[model samples]
Target: MSATSTVRRFRTLAVPLAVLTVVFLVISLPPYLGLDPAKARLPVPEDVPWFYPALVAHIGFGSIALLTAALQVWPWLRRTHPAVHRWSGRIYLGLGVIPGGVAVLAVAPFGQTGGPTGQVANTMLALLWLATAVAGYRAARARRFGEHREWMVRNVALTFSIVANRPWSMLCIAVFAPEVMGTGPVDPAVLAQAAGVSMWLSWVVNLLVAEYWLHRTRTRRGVRGGPTAKHRQPVPATS
Candidate 1:
């Protein structure tokens, strides 16, 4: 319908999503911050001495990415506080995505339960995460605001994938390998299979949903720009 209605609908979704994103980050990041490999949710492979360190780096920087992504995509922040948007975007790309992506690549090969499928999934996610962040940054630098928004949206989707992964992993385990979820000792092979399934499901579903949302926004607005600029504020020079 109208631009105002469209924006209102987006605001309704964006606000809760941002809140939940912060909630997820709070629940996930603190344990890793202690730098204890034993505290990691995934089973850290002892043979790979660097895996735990890399996993810590990934989680640490990824937490920053996820946190800043909430601010970066919030309509009110971009419209009313463009400087915050730009600075957060910079932090998301520079301090978060780049380092986080590298750390994920380092740990992908040593995934505890996902096996080769998990490794491939993680590697692909890291590559796509870095690529989208870079593309978004370049688009902003080129003053291609519309393209930049779309790219950043993709980056945000990737950032949120890990938050979605927990539920997906649990679901996969419950359905495909219920024994893995038992109180008794788990079969490593079954756990690995379930984890591999979850790894594929989580990011793929997130990306698909993101693409669908982008397409719907474009269709409704009939613009290559994913969202309307009617409420956009002038970005600060320092941004």
Candidate 2:
């Protein structure tokens, strides 16, 4: 096979991998969605005034954005049905990002575990999510498609923090399992600090990975034709 064919085959995997990730998140969510404090994975208590409503908004709209982004990233869909892509992008910005990010921003402050660290980390996540989403829309409206795609990439990475945050926190717990399990109950302060560290790490790691990916792709495009190739067309998988 030629080198071009190899690259083509490799690039084809991006959408499928993204689709699988979204599917995994969808399947993983039912356990976290209910009102029962026992069933809720978020540390926010059921008795808390903000928990249920905020949880519903975050889960409901975030799930929409997550699923929509998976489809939006498929090169075939955007290539063949550009209108669908445009409409869905609007949906992604409207019902998906607005309510979803705002819901988390409003609630994360009151509910975060880490005394200061967790609160700050989550607050940043919420702000970055909303800001990137807004920037993506503004870029699209301005017809700066490349900038729009990059902004959307950042937005999606932050949004995926929901999925990434859980596993990260669990890994942190696993690392300290001996100490935590030995104690009758882990101190709330300790739990808070752990959660804060995990939250920061999860979103930061995602953004780093995304920036590296965007940079690598642009480099590849530049190598092909001195940086004009990516500018000539919007990237389908970027959304």
Candidate 3:
């Protein structure tokens, strides 16, 4: 490839790879790695018995989404055997539904953020994520390839929130830690709400960036006739 082409490819790969790497490390790491025992923490409320199960389900499904997302982007897996891609896609879709649906249920009664604004934001995010995933699956089933691809991209963007949440949380704490420490520490309740909002916001930003990138790629390829070109030379024009 030309220098320009190489640079373009590098630019295309770098950000997503960095984001994915950070996300994978954060999620895959032991849960206790960054814990501060002195900080205000939200323990699962014993009064609400279902909290533990919901949290477990959320994390489990989030992990499945992350794993399958990484697999979906593998060139060998995606291009070499599309059958495997399709199978994996279906599994990912199925696995996502339960947690995505339950997220809506859990967000409202979220003990950490009980107020109206928090409830509304959490509910909206959950519903939006779930709806996008469902729309992607439906579009795929209907053989609307372009729509399917777009919706799936959006779904994956939402899925990335699972990864983005941690980094955002860390940043929030870092910036506010001194104030928090001085003023009786950050309330776990407020932190949790902020984290949730930040997580969804990260995904939304990623989705917009991905959409722009995909558009630019498609436009460039169209102009160059890169992938869809049949041949360089043309035979005599058909009547």
Computed on alpha carbons, the lDDT of every model, listed in order, comes to 0.83, 0.78, 0.62
Model 2, 157-191: lDDT tens digits are 88788778778988877665435767566676776
TM-score of each: 0.84, 0.81, 0.68
How many residue-pair clashes does candidate 3 contain?
0
The alpha-carbon root-mean-square deviation between model 2 and the true structure, to one decimal in Å, is 5.4
Native-to-model Cα distance after best TM-score fit, residue 197 in candidate 3, in Å: 4.4
Model 1, 1-239: lDDT tens digits are 89997787566456776788788878887778778878888888878999988988888898888777877777766887899889988898889999999999999977866999899999999999989888888878977787798888888888888988889988988887787656677777887888898888888888888889887776878555544642355678893
- Model 1 TM-score relative to the real fold: 0.84
How far off is residue 71 in model 3, in Å? Answer: 1.7
Clashes of each: 0, 1, 0
Q: How many residue pairs in model 2 have overlapping backbones? A: 1
Candidate 3 Cα errors over 4 Å, as ranges: 1-42, 97-100, 111-118, 175-178, 181-197, 221-239
Q: Pick the candidate with the highest lDDT.
A: 1
Q: How accurate is candidate 3 locally (lDDT)?
A: 0.62
Sorting all predicted structures by lDDT, with the top scorer first, yields 1, 2, 3
- TM-score, candidate 3, is 0.68
Off by over 4 Å in 2: 1-28, 31-38, 45-48, 181-185, 229-239
59-168 per-residue lDDT for model 3 (tens digits):
55666666677555554556568898898887777785447457546734564543444556556667877888888888778766666767777777667765665676
**Candidate 1 residue runs with Cα over 4 Å from true position:** 1-12, 181-186, 223-239
Ranking by TM-score: 1, 2, 3
